[model samples]
Target: MQQIFDFKALVKYRDRAAQRLGTVTPVLEELTDRLLDRLDDTTSRFSTALDFGGRGVLAPMLKARGISVDSADFSALLAAKAGGTPLPLPGPADFKLTQARYDLIVAPLSLHGLDDLPGALIQFRRALKPEGLLLASLPVLGTLHELRLNLLETEETLTGKVSPRISPFPELRDCAGLLQRAGFTHPVADIEELEFLYANPLALLHELRDAGEGNALCARSRAIPPRALFPAALAAMPRKEGRMVARLRMAVLTGWAS
Candidate 1:
């Protein structure tokens, strides 16, 4: 019901990421592989799939398995470039697809930004055939928590005020509940926590930018932050083996349409 994201900004950042990424984002590839690995755990056979918010990674793998794939994203450019269809991101109420059209729908690392995640999930469920599956990967609470904490502490220490700098993510326990609320059957949610050694904290920031993980919160601070904010924050990060350790927690959600 509340619009928390700036869709225009989301699309702009996504397009920039799409152009810059060009199918070579290690993080995206990692998540896609993980999602597919879960797919292998199932015995269901799918002839068609919709790769939602795909970055040109998941569809190819599915195609190789003889499954027809259609791609969609919040960015039309990305939707076309990745999946060959120029579908724009749909609002919760506006997401329309042929009923019972696809046997599988895969959404990777894209659900966290939606203002109406439950509504979107319902729409996704509606577009699937009976007994079809919906699989999605999204960042959960505590993902990038260290960075968020450091940034907030540094900013508050410097300016005595704080505004949202990082986006909020869904909690792990609530993911499956969302599916159930959307009328999914046998909904399940699990998580994988991955730690990466970054050359430095700045490298993490750069990768996020390159990945188009920019802040799109409608309430985000528009004014440029203090010049020393990032430096101060990054300097405060914990180190592991002389490198900055960044932890990413991705939640995998699964449900059957029927």
Candidate 2:
């Protein structure tokens, strides 16, 4: 893949909000359990661990297991607090990691945030041993379908635009193919759908912000969203009996180094 243009927003975004990073752990841990269950053996020579998107939660878990985990995050603040070394690049680094060299890497619900996903996958593949495993969970194409639909509806109603601020996530088949292309073997991918009920659209938005999750539109400026867009956006949401609902599709991929 061609190199991505230099862009660095998530670093500052995540750095100042490390505390909110733990909110997604319930969803991530669910996927993590499935990945671990599928592993051939937990006691195998997988002595070292790497948490690629590790900010607050996964880092602690790996440490508790007595494994030396090299935590990587865009947030320098998070890396410092978690006792991790920061990744040198914004999206993907071509160098190998020597901070306790990892045999298993866990990146949950974060791959879509990259600018050069294919290149990043290759980097992760190279960071592992021949028998090492990568347990990755990502928000795929169908993720947040309800939210996307709502955004489209709101766009049409308010601005006559039918698109959203966030990019569409990678399709499941495409993700598996990308992993294979990145040189992983026995690649397996699966999906788990999560439905969250909210009292209102504002509540849902608050939750997302509180969790430090937001649109990753790289080209968008730092200006605040217009006030008029708020209500229209909320009105476009899926409401049943005065309650709004959102669906999150989480995809998990497991592969071994070739």
Candidate 3:
């Protein structure tokens, strides 16, 4: 299969950023809380849980709630920081399952970057005990639409062509289908739209970098984008109360293992 993301590079960058930035993704933190709240409302309690791709946020939260949580992350640095295990990138074969099965598995703000999301979901299902719950939040279609459009327009105008700058995200409409295809039962998907205000476009770009969400597209441009593009994109953002606003949409998915 053709590669869509440079996942290895992504892991490296994220690990380094974690070491330097010291766990700064408030969005992930908020999403983790939301997932836990959902679990609380639906189920009484989970005895054992796995925090997948949380990088460090969900494990502590689960433990605080009296759940036995084991954390796993794609970045070695992040894993070390979280005092958890490291997960290898998804490949043709499924990940090796642990001897102990989990009652719940939660992945927050992480699944969207996977090249083989279906395969990962299958692995998640197999790793869980029967009827165990899976909850995941991923940035879906329409995430950063403003930034994507601005980049496209500015790059095209400056270079006479455009290259992929933002990674493609899964559509909310397709989330349930993917879960079903992965053999997950009782799949449910919902979307949450969020808007953030930044002082300028450079602030937005800096936030993305600090969050380890910089461009990771395999087909992304090798040459540096024109400096003018940044200001142009910033200027193009919708201004509300004199602050530039960017939009993001997150798809939260839930399923049960049979």
Q: Where does model 3 exceed 4 Å of error?
A: 21-23, 83-93
Give model 2's TM-score versus the native structure: 0.83
Task: Report the lDDT tens digits of candidate 1 across residue range 1-258.
Answer: 788988778878888988777534666787799988988898999998998888878788788888988887877778887753446666535667778999999998888778989888988998999999999999999898988999999999999999888899889999999999999999999999998787767888878877778999999999999999998998887789988888889999999998
Ranking by TM-score: 1, 3, 2
What's the ranking of the predictions by lDDT, best on top? 1, 3, 2
lDDT (C-alpha) at residue 20 in model 3: 51
Strongest candidate by TM-score: 1
- Write the residue-wise lDDT of candidate 2 on 92-185 in tens digits: 4543455225788888666776677877778888878877888888788876676667666765666565434555688877878888988999
Residue 90 CA displacement from its true place in model 1, Å:
4.5
- Provide the TM-score for each candidate, comma-separated: 0.96, 0.83, 0.92
RMSD of 3: 2.0
| Residue 2, model 2: Cα distance from true site in angstroms | 8.0
Error of 1 at 182 (Å): 0.4
> What C-alpha RMSD separates each model from the true structure?
1.4, 3.3, 2.0
The weakest ten consecutive residues by lDDT in model 3 span 83-92
